[model samples]
Target: MDQDDSETCQMCPMDEWPNREKTRCLPKLQEFLSYKEDKMASFFCFLVILCCVITCFTLKKFILYWDTPLVKANNRTLSFTVLVSLLLSFLCVFFFLGRPLDITCMLRQTLFGIFFSLAISSLIAKSMMVCIAFKATKPSSSWKKWTGVTLPYSIVVVCSSVQVLICVSWLSTYPPYQGFDMTTYPGKIIIQCNEGSDIWFYSMLGYLGFLAAVSFVLAFMVRTLPDSYNEAKYITFSMLVFCSVWIAMIPAYLSTRGKYMVAVEIFAILTSCAGILSCIFLPKLYILLIKPYLNTRKHVFSWVRK
Candidate 1:
C-alpha cells in the first residue's frame, strides 16, 4: 500500500512559537521576573522584605530615642522622612517582580522615582542644615534665619515636587504599558513594560543623579565640621555610593535583555538604598544603642570645643 504524502508546514502565528520537534505551535513562554518561577525574583523579594524590616526596626529605634542628642542633632524630622521614603522605595521593588501589567508598569518606575527623590531631598536638606548651622555660628551670620525648620522642609518639598512633576508629565504624555517582545529569544516572549518615552525616563534618573551630586557637594563642603554637627561626612559618602550604583547600573541595564534588565534595576535600588541607610544611620544607631554616653549633649559640646 502507498503511504500518504507529507504536506508543507504552515507558519505559526506571531503570538505562538513552534516546539523543538516542530510538531505543533505552542504558546510562547512568557518571560518576566516571576516571583514563583525565577530564583532571582525570589531573592529580590527576600532582599526587599529584609531591607524593609531593617528600616522599620531603625525607625523604631529612632522613635524610642527621639529625645537623644544624636537623634535631635541629625534632625529627627528629616531622618524620619528618609526612613519612610526608603521603606516606600523598597516596597516599589515588588512592582517589578511579577508579570508586567499596566498598573505595575506605571507605578514601578514613577513610584521609585518619586520615593528616591524624597529620600535624596531629605539628605540634601540635612546637608544644607549642617552648612547653615555651621555658618550661623559666625558672628552676624545671616544664615541664622535659615537655621529654622522652614528652610529644610522647604528644600525637601521643592526638590521632591520637581520629581513628582516629571513623573506626572511622563504619565500624562506617554504612560508605560505592558508589552511583549517575541524576537529577542526564540521560542519565548519577553513580557516587559515599554518605557513610553526614553527622554522622560532618563530625565527622572538624571534628576535623581543631580540631587545626589548636589548633596554630595554640599555635604563634602561641611564634612570637616566638628564631630558634634558633622553628619555631613556620612551624607557625602552615601551620595557617593548612590551615584556610583546608578552610574554603573546604566550601562549594565542597557546591555542586558528581558528579565536580567529588570534584575539590574532592582539590584540598583536595593544597593543604593542600603548604602544610604547604612552610611547615615548605622553610626547614629551605634551611638544611641551601644554608646549612650556619646549620645549626650555633653559629648557633643566637647566635640564642638575641639
Candidate 2:
C-alpha cells in the first residue's frame, strides 16, 4: 500500500479544503461577492462610498444654511436625520462584500432594512408635517398645536421604532449564517449567506414600502399647494422615484441568483437614495447656491402671486 494512501490529510477548517494530491490545502469556494475578485461589486462599493462622502458635504452645507427660510419651511432636524440614514444605507453595502461571516451575514440585511426604514419614516414625517401645517392655518384648527417639531419627531421615532422591533425579533428567532450553495452553478461552489427567513426579509421590505407609499400619497395630494410654502411637489417626485426603483427591484431581485442577487439590491439602494437626494434637495440647493435671489421671501411670494 502507498504511504500517501494510508495517511489521511489534516482536517481543514471551514474555509479551506485539502488539495487533490492531499499534500497541501487550498481555499474552499468563497461564495460572497468579493471586491478582490468581482470588479462589478468593487465598482459599486466605490461609487456608493463616494456618494456617501458627497452626501456628507451636502449635509454640512445644509446645516450651515439651516436658518434659511427655504430650509426652515419643514423640519430641518428630520431632514438631517434622513440624510444621515441615507448615508448609512449607502455604506451598508460593504457588509455584503468579501467573505460571508456569521456576523456580517446577520447584519448586512438587517442594517440595510433598518437604515432604509429610518429614511422612509423621516420622509413620511416630513410629508405629514406639511399636511399639518396647511391644516393649522384654517379657522379653529386644532392642528396648530401639532405644527411644531414634536409631531414630526414623534413620527420619525415611532415609525422607526417599529422596524427596530421587527429586526430584533427576526434576529433573535432566525439569524442569518454563512452557507455554501453547491447546486446553483455547475462544477463550482458558491458561498453565500443563508438569510434565516425569507418571510422576515420580505416583511422588512414591505414595511419600508408601506411608509414610502404613505409619503407618496400624502405628498401627491398636496403637490398642487404653493411650492413656496410646501415642498410637496418635490416630495411627491422623490417618493415616486423611490417607489419606482424598489418596485422594479422586487422582480429582478427575485429572479437573480448568487452574487447578482446582492448586486441588484445594492443597485436599488444607491438608486433610491440618489433619487431622494436629487429630487428633494437638488432644486433647493440650486436655489440656495446659483439663484440665491429666488430663495428670498419676497421672490417666493411674488412668484406665488404670479
Candidate 3:
C-alpha cells in the first residue's frame, strides 16, 4: 500500500530495489569481476603476467640458439608461432577479468579462440613435418616434396585461416554485449556479457575442439618415432590436457552464474595454455639449458640411427 493512500501501491525506480520488509526502496548493488574486491581475479591477473614473462624468456632463449642444431631440429618458424600464440592466449584472460564492456565482451572469447587455434595448428604442422621428414629419408620417396618449409607453412596458414573466418562470421552477425542480470539475485544487478548467440559461441568452441582433435590424432600417429626429430609425443600430451580441460569446463560454465561463471572460463584458459606451454616446450628447454651436450648434431644422429 502507498503511504498517502492505503488502496494504492507504488513501484520502486529502476536504480532501487525493495527492502526486505517492503517498506521502502534501497539502492541496488552492482556486481562484477573487480580486481580490487575479487581475490580470484587478482590471482588470475598475477598468473597471467607470470605466464607471459615465462613465454618471453623462453622465446628469448630460442632466439639466442636460433642457429643451434636443437632449435633447427624442430621447425623454428612453427615453434616461434606456437610461442607467440600461447603468449597472446595468456594475455587474453585480462578481458574477462575486468568489468564487462561492449568491446571486451566481443573480443575476449574470439581472441582466445583464434590464438589457441593458431597454437594447435602450429603443433599439427610440426607433427606433419616430423612424419614427412622420417619418410623422406627413404630413397626416392614422394614425401621428399613435403620436407621443405612450404608444406608446414601452408598448413599453418590454411588451418588458422579457417578459425579466423569463423570468428569473423560470429562477430559480424550476433555479437556479445554487456548485459545486466537483476533476477538472479535480489537487490543486486549482476553485470555480465550476454553472449548474443549460444549457437555461435558453441560453434566457435566446437571448431576449436575439432582442430584440437585433428592435431591430437595426427600427433598420436607419429608419437612412436625417435625423440630427436619427433615432437609428436609432446604435442599429443598437450592436446590431451587441453581437450580435457575444455570438455570439463563446458558443464561447469553452464551451471554457474555471475562472477563465478567468468572465473571458470578464466581457469580453463590458463590451465590449458599452461598445459601446452609446459608439455611442448619444457623438455626442449631442459635440453637447451641443462643438457647442452645432447643438443649436438652428433647425438641427434646417434639417436636417429638407433
| TM-score list, all predictions | 0.96, 0.88, 0.96
Give the alpha carbon lDDT tens digit for every residue of 165-280 in model 3.
88898899999999999888878889999989898889889988998999999999999988777789999999999899999999999999999999999999999999999999
Error in Å for residue 294 of model 3: 1.0
Residues 143-245, model 1: lDDT tens digits? 8988989999999999999999999999999999999999989888999999999999999999999999999999999899888768999999999999999
User: Lowest-lDDT window of 10 residues in candidate 3?
Assistant: 1-10
Pairs in steric clash, model 2: 31-191
Clashes per candidate (backbone, < 3 Å): 0, 1, 0
Candidate maximizing lDDT: 1
- Let me know the TM-score candidate 3 reaches against the reference structure: 0.96
Pairs of residues at least 3 apart in sequence or in different chains that clash in candidate 1:
none
List of clashing residue pairs for candidate 3? none
The C-alpha lDDT values of all candidates are 0.92, 0.82, 0.91
